[model samples]
Target: MAQAMLLSLRRISRSFGGIQALDNVSLDIAKGDVIGLVGDNGAGKSTLIKVLAGAHDPTSGDVILEGRPQKLSPPAEAQRLGIETVYQDLSLIGTFTAAENFFLGREIAIGRGPALLRWIRRKSMGDTAMRGLEELNIDIPGIRSKPVDRMSGGQRQLVAIARGAFWGHKLLLLDEPTAALGVRESREVLDLIKRLGAQGLTIVMVTHNLDHLWQVCNRVVVMRRGRKAADLASSATNMEDVVAYITGAKEPMTPRPATTEAGA
Candidate 1:
């Protein structure tokens, strides 16, 4: 038998007064599947992700998680429901050490009452943070004590990912993870995303780079002008099709002039 769907956006809609950010958008995500959302600048890709990440509530419609209907009113609600999002900006405290950032806002308490304020459990937090990185197959040059400001862009991305994965989240939303990374760093980040998917976490990445989408996603959903244009299996379709969908060219032709950008 087939497995049950992990997340579903049922007729989801969001608007900004005169502008409809998303219009009756519906999507179903399965467990362990990597789906890429593609669109133009105003195509509502970010808005859709924000809704899924609990950054915005739908103007109308429901976001159902794990077969149960829910109203995701706040980002905290989604986080509590095992949904984690690592945005491009990735809100990390650069001044904090790796371990400090890892355990930020979630310090290990020593007791259940007022006596619990024993201070930050330094040793335990560092060890646990290191192990989490190891589990994600990340190699840290320094110990967890290294400040995030000292780490590379790729390392910072890894830290964001490690934070989400450590809690065994059910769904992870990635917004342009590889946008500014160099060749090797981009590859590393993509590999990590795949590893997370292999470990059974659903991933929904929003990117215009069809090459990255082709490399990391199993399915691709195209969004155009605040609406879904098409949803196709990556293997069954090529870059030409995606470009065609994005540009509204709908040209009856081959070799989309913008096809070469796929390997990046």
Candidate 2:
């Protein structure tokens, strides 16, 4: 028998001012799944991420987490529901140390009373941060306290991922994580993403890199004109199909489950 889905979006719709960003889109993401969402510039890929991450409320539709309906009014609400988003051009504090940035706005502290509260537990955060970085194979030279100002760009992005992976990341949404990275750096980031997914974190990556998608994702979700064009099993699909979808050479085809529903 098939297992219950972990997340589902129902009749989702969104718009910005007068522009229709998403048009009654819907999908499901199950546990231990990695979905690669691909589309053109204005195909609503980023907009969908923001909606799922709680950065933007959908004009309509509800996000179901753990099979329970949820209203994602803000990013904090999404995080509370174990949803994390790692976005391109929106990672790390260039001025803070890696350890500092790791616990930014979310420090791990030790205290008993309100008046007798203790100082910041640097050692605790540092230790955990070190373990996370090691797991990701992110080389930060010396200690985990090394400042981001001294670290490489790739390191910065890796740290951001490690931060999310260290906490509530049951459903991770990665938007162009390697968009501006060097070849080697991009691989490092992609490897970390895979490592996280291997740990049973359901991940959705919005990337333009077909090779990376083929390498990491179990399924692919292609969008066109703000609607889902295809949701194909990676092994059952081909480059020709994806290219055809991207260029509109092929008409959009819904997933097989949707077809079965109509027949039923």
Candidate 3:
């Protein structure tokens, strides 16, 4: 049986002055889907993801989530609607502990009367962050106290991902998640991605790594020069085919017309 659709991008397009970043791209995301968005540097992959992340508003098109049109803009709106984006930079404060970074803006506070009089509930926040990590089977020793800068690259990436997973109830957008990690670290991050997908989070990952994509993504969407070139099942397509789509060496396949008998 087909999974129900979770989100849809209807003829999405984005432009920067005269340059078109995305042109009439449409895509459907099902519940619990791990979609890999791949393309060359100027292929509009980042633009499309930014549109979805609400970092960039589409010049045209609608973002439909759970059958309703969404006005995802200025980042916060998208966050409120359960869409979280983890950029390649990881976006963690180097001086802050994992728990502190986890609840950066949405800090837990204790006290009643006025906001200024309230004290930040550090213990509760740390405990909650630890629990969230544990639930995801992420083992980060001293995550509540260790500064993100002191941690390894993979650990910091995991922390960023964990924060996104904890807050994003609907969709998780990852941009080059393993772009800057060692082999083992990349493997760990990929494993975590699989776990997140298995737990029913719809994921849209923008990556150039076909190996990682094959391991974790169910669907692959390729873009070329600001337009969607192909969308294929990762299990069904090979790396060569995907690379062909990415480099524009091979064109997207189209269905052939049905043929009747010669003399019918």
Per-model TM-score versus the true fold: 0.90, 0.91, 0.93
Runs in model 3 lying further than 4 Å from the true structure:
111-117, 253-264
Q: RMSD to native for every prediction?
A: 6.4, 2.7, 4.9
lDDT of 1 by residue, 77-102 (tens): 88878888888965679888877777
Model 1 TM-score, all chains together:
0.90
The lDDT, on a scale of 0 to 1, for candidate 3 is 0.89
Off by over 4 Å in 2: 112-118, 255-264
**What shift in Å separates residue 236 of candidate 3 from its native position after superposition?**
1.7
Q: Give the alpha-carbon lDDT of every model.
A: 0.81, 0.81, 0.89
**With candidate 1 superimposed using the best TM-score fit, by how many Å does residue 228's alpha carbon deviate from the native?**
1.0
Query: Which candidate has the highest TM-score of all?
Result: 3
Candidate 3 deviation (Cα RMSD): 4.9
Per-residue lDDT of model 2, residues 162-221, tens digit only: 877776567888888888889998888888888887888888999998988988899898
Model 2: C-alpha RMSD to truth? 2.7
Runs in model 1 with CA error above 4 Å? 112-118, 251-264
